[model samples]
Target: MKKKIHGFIEKIIENDIKKNNQMILRTRFPPEPNGYLHIGHVKSIYLNFTLAEYYNGLCNLRYDDTNPKKEKKKFVNAIKKDILWMGFNIKNITFTSEYFDILYTYAVELIKKKLAYVDQLTKKEIHDYRGTLKQKGINSPYRNQNVQKNLDLFSKMKNGFFSEGTVCLRAKINMSSSSIIMRDPVLYRVIESKHYHTQNKWFIYPTYDFAHCISDAIEGITHSLCTLEFQENKKLYEWILTNISVSNYPRQYEYARLKLEFTILSKRKLQILIEKKIISGWDDPRIPTISGLRNKGYTPESLRDFVQKTGFSKQDSLIPLHLLESSIRKDLNMKSIRRMAVIDPLLIIIENIDLLHCENITVPNHPNVPTMGSRKIIFSREIYINRDDFKEYADDNYTRLTYNNEVRLRYAYTIKVTRIEKNKKNEIIKLFCIYDKNTFKTQPKNKKISGVIHWISKKNVIPTKFYFYSPLFTIKNPDLEKNFLNYISKKSKIKKNGFIEKDLPNNISCIPYQFERIGYFIIKKEKNKLTTCHQTVSLK
Candidate 1:
């Protein structure tokens, strides 16, 4: 389904702009470059950028790099790459650090107006004073620092006079305010550590609550959009900009973030998984990070299409994980080429091979699309079929191979099973069959063969690896669990060696192959070369 641009926020933007003749619809995608961007962030990026495009307004890709302790250059680079890969042409790139001087001026202005004060409370003291929802907070003892004294102390702190965690600047809002976030949220904190962008230029850093709205106002952003989790912080966001006397402050709007089922989008939890070595780094295909999904061969078109299908809404809901899978399946079904692969190989030898010569079958790459072209597949006397396709003894309803039962081999002749050989463990090792040439593209004349199977010519097959992926967690709602790692699936991945059609295009990028009767498989790369093929989804 195509996504429609009909959210209430869009309407609000249009109406507000029309009401104010001089106003413009400018927006920003402010991502804190602390970790790799996940699918949850994708929705926000799409919304902000698309809204700006639809309104013929300016959209900036700004990094809210306030927390120097967690921000990094690598994460920043990864973020830029992810956005570009998703097909967004971001014209303006800005950073909060770029406006550090301006933001510092605003903070000083707040202090001069007696709306903000430098606090000497310890970290725990601050938290304990910040009462819970049922209680009212208490003002910090140092909240009354005079303008001149506060200005000197704040300057010294910024000039590296104060040690980290000794003091912080706070807003002078009412302690008894009903909005807990308005009860004097921290505006700036002293951090002696170096930053990726600023290096050791300063010892103090502005907090997100202070910097976010101030930066938006400084850039003349018309709509300050964020996820609903920050609904409480909207009060503080407005307070900072209003108290600073900014000429035009952006209005903040909150929308529900993507909470996908069977997936966890919390960067902290994802870090834990990486530190614990539960899966590979952030690009592990099991996780839903943009890089992880890209590694799993998800197309940017599919991602954009998926985002569009889930229209903007204020309500939060857990979307089924299959909705994402369905998007990729829809795209691949039309574009992906077709081939035959047999994993868990069972060798089948034709009994009358001396009489029945081998043949070549020209099969279309796509069953429904002729322009996709065709690939030549060998139909030899000896071939490898999937072990699951055959049974030593079967019920009448079995649609696949059984002893003495004739079955149709996809794109080739029909074969009658004659015998089955077993190993010492009583496992079926091999199959012997006879081909009926008259059933090449049609069923038998006398009766119908219910069984239809897929095979690869053993003589002309290339052994390949197939990675079968399952849900990362055993349960659907692992995010709600106390310890999501407890539900990590033991069988999340199944590795099988298969024989695929020989001479598949080498050195080609992530092209999906439909393994005849099997599911779609995308090539897995090792240093930009094909290493194995991963099954994207099951045929069913």
Candidate 2:
């Protein structure tokens, strides 16, 4: 409902209600319950729901479950959960299959009116006959069958008398029409799988094109919005509605679908990832699926802000991945509380500090929002700092700890490293430092501090696995490759056994916290087992 770039679609809706007293804005988010909802679907989801809300109308969450082979109740539930997570209230939950009886009758009426027929053409023959734009399509051998015969054949198809794909009912629209969707598109098909909603009561099912327009009409949806890929199908959509006695069928409008670089929006490709064990599951943090993003610490406000900022338009464009990140960064910068994590811990022994001298340091939960209060972190003789925060070598510009360099500890005393300890392989295992004995925050005379570094007491830290997640594909435009998987980022997810302050929250509830120098992270689970967490974004 946020004000975005106004396009012609908004004008159309605004003008429609302006003209007629009876006009009411209604919309629906009709998703095929074939797989879990993904990020691409988010734009359409919020658009439909928010538009209805903007007009003081209602939005329905409808599952276009005509294809029972891939559709399942679990998928329906998952989609519902995702929509709810987006912060919208869906009052009407309907399925296209719920109108199967009416839809079947409509098919019968179309056949009776000689607007449709059952075609016996094989799959290859149908494609061969559909003819390219340069050539006109040849009529199917069964195109002129009598309405009675077509009706009987369709009835037989519905009764499961024929094997799947043996025959299907097709609209008898102009075969030579330049729009291929109008070249006698399939209106009904034989899907023998038991539907999750209707069980085995029906064998033949209406195709997406056949059910979608009529469903919108039946629901009295004022503006049926779709992605630009279906723009060509609009003619067929209106034609079906006009011929089917839908007195007040909804008008269809097409806008660009959300496309992200290094991401595939195709449900089929996402299913491939699940099928081949390419990733963990539908909710893999690497995937563009909504559940995946939600688990990866994405907030709904950030998602909505992302879509609104991207703006709705008719022309499609591939969006940079950083645009999405920017939205998240903008959202979390004001909210995510600061925490300290040492992913690659280097022991720092403060030789001058002991149990008696050590004290608890209090830091603001959020530097900007004092209302979030503060948390206490302990300091002791033995503590851990990030290994990258120190090195055996240094330059004048080096802002972090180096051999014999003085640096300020975040929310703690200043220290000067005396020596670095290494193991047999020459890995810097620890650093010995002497802390300033001053009881107040102070700058060492004759030296400006290098930089502030975050550390935790070695005695009271909790070790947890932190996952650094990047794009699933290595290349920016991965979908261009014939084998998108060839560009799959092997290091899309990297796990580190990290240490966090012992006072950190045990339950995250999907809220991400900034880990000081590290990125934002949220607790995640795999297969019901609490597992490695994910980095939502980096500080830079």
The total of clashing pairs for model 2 equals 0
lDDT values, one for every candidate: 0.85, 0.86
lDDT of 2 by residue, 279-345 (tens): 8888988888999988788899999989888888888899999999999989999889888889878
Lowest lDDT block of 10, candidate 1: 522-531
Q: How far is candidate 2 from the true structure (C-alpha RMSD, Å)?
A: 1.9
Number of the top lDDT candidate = 2
TM-score, each model? Answer: 0.96, 0.96
Deviation in angstroms for 60 in model 1?
0.6
